[model samples]
Target: MSFKNLPLLGTAEIIGALNLSPKQTASAANLAHRVAQSAWRRQPPHKRGLSYEEFASTVSDCAWLTMFEFGALLALGRHHEALLLADASRMVHHSARTDPPK
Candidate 1:
């Protein structure tokens, strides 16, 4: 598929297109979360994971949810809450990386 077609799609749809199983989907999500978290924890911080840009470009439904939640918190001026969400997202990422599904 092409980048232009991503926004119109969802994760399940993508997985379906790729013929991936539920376990595979979960595993991939976990793997991606870990990678994103590691980048976020870097000294200078990294622009990785399912960021708004990446979601928009790649049409990742999960990333879209995260970006929406983060943006909503920021819009409400809940900086602390947003940070917590970010930290949580990072933790999930780490979990996925360290304890991948079988």
Candidate 2:
């Protein structure tokens, strides 16, 4: 048996959730991942449970869901949005490091 038929490894797994071709998956995944930070999130921002679980599981991993969301925007050449997301992620990390825990 071969593992080739299995789900992707590393970052490739990100776009695999979207049924995309191998060549397009990497960039698509990167773009979606950065911009789709809220893809699986509940719109109202306070709800979480089994219902949310089902919604959350739709893409297996958050990165995949993010890819599904941002892939379309990437298709439209939204590189700036993707960059902004990356910067925001960095800012979040920096803040977390600087802030004291409550």
Please provide TM-scores, in order, for all candidate models, with all chains considered together: 0.43, 0.36
Which number leads on TM-score? 1
Please state the error at residue 37 of candidate 2 in Å: 23
- Model 2, range 3-86, lDDT digits (tens) per residue? 221234644544444455544554555544443335545355564443533653454443454444355345546668756755
Model 1 misplacement above 4 A: 1-59
Model 1 scores a TM of 0.43
Q: On residues 47-76, what C-alpha lDDT tens digit does candidate 1 reach at each position?
A: 445554453455345664454445445544
Whole-model lDDT for model 1 versus the true structure? 0.52
Give the clashing pairs for model 1. Answer: 33-93, 34-93
Q: What lDDT is reached at residue 79 by model 1?
A: 75
